[model samples]
Target: MTTQRTITVDQARQIVFDAYTTGLPQAAAAKLLTGQATQAWVTSEYAALRRRGIPAMSGQGSLFDPAAEN
Candidate 1:
């Protein structure tokens, strides 16, 4: 039998960040944090992190990066 540990959302978010710092993809981090791998939740949490000035994704559209000037 396995028992699931109860963790607050903040703790979960920190876990996600820690995973990212260790080179895990945001989706993977989200899965580890929530125990579920779903695009919807990953996307939502990624956006939340971005809103809080954290870059939760990679590439040119990264929220923490400056937008390229045209």
Candidate 2:
């Protein structure tokens, strides 16, 4: 049997930031922090990190190849 952990926002922040350097997604960090990957909270937390001036592990936005069509 496994036990679940209860975490606070500060802990979530730490998980997000530290795990980000390890290529962990916001949802993944949320999972480690809150035991479940909630997109809403993950997104808000990610934005909070950005507001604190922490750059994401990867540059945002991907270069779309318009030439590739279905």
Candidate 3:
């Protein structure tokens, strides 16, 4: 026999990324996003956001290149 558990969709997504994705493990990513280095975290966060209906940025641009980014 087995017991079932309940979890929200958002929670499930978080778990999915935690279980998958490469570079900067989940805890560090979360901390970086929620705490310091918000902009740096945006790259990975946006990737996750894309999975949940958020669209990716258009065109090619370097975060380091202000002109290209715009």
- Identify the leading candidate in terms of TM-score: 2
Model 3, span 1-70: residue lDDT tens = 9555655546645643443343344555555334333444445654666577632332222334587645
Arrange candidates by TM-score, highest first: which order? 2, 1, 3
Rank list by lDDT: 2, 1, 3
Q: TM-scores of the models, in the given order?
A: 0.50, 0.54, 0.28
Which lDDT value does model 3 have at 1? 100
- Candidate 1 lDDT by residue in tens digits, 1-70: 9877877767766676666445567767666756534557656766676678754344335434566542
Question: How does candidate 2 fare on TM-score?
Answer: 0.54
Look at candidate 2 and tell me the lDDT of residue 17: 68
Cα RMSD, each candidate: 8.9, 9.0, 12.9
By the TM-score metric, which is better: model 1 or model 2? Answer: 2
TM-score of 3: 0.28
> Candidate 3: where is the Cα deviation over 4 Å?
22-70
Give the best candidate by lDDT: 2
Model 3, position 63, has a per-residue lDDT of 37
lDDT (10s digit) by residue, model 2, range 2-64: 888777767766667677655677767766766544768778877777788766754322224
Q: Cα RMSD (Å) between model 1 and the true structure?
A: 8.9
Runs in model 1 deviating more than 4 A are 34-39, 51-70
lDDT of 1 at 15: 71
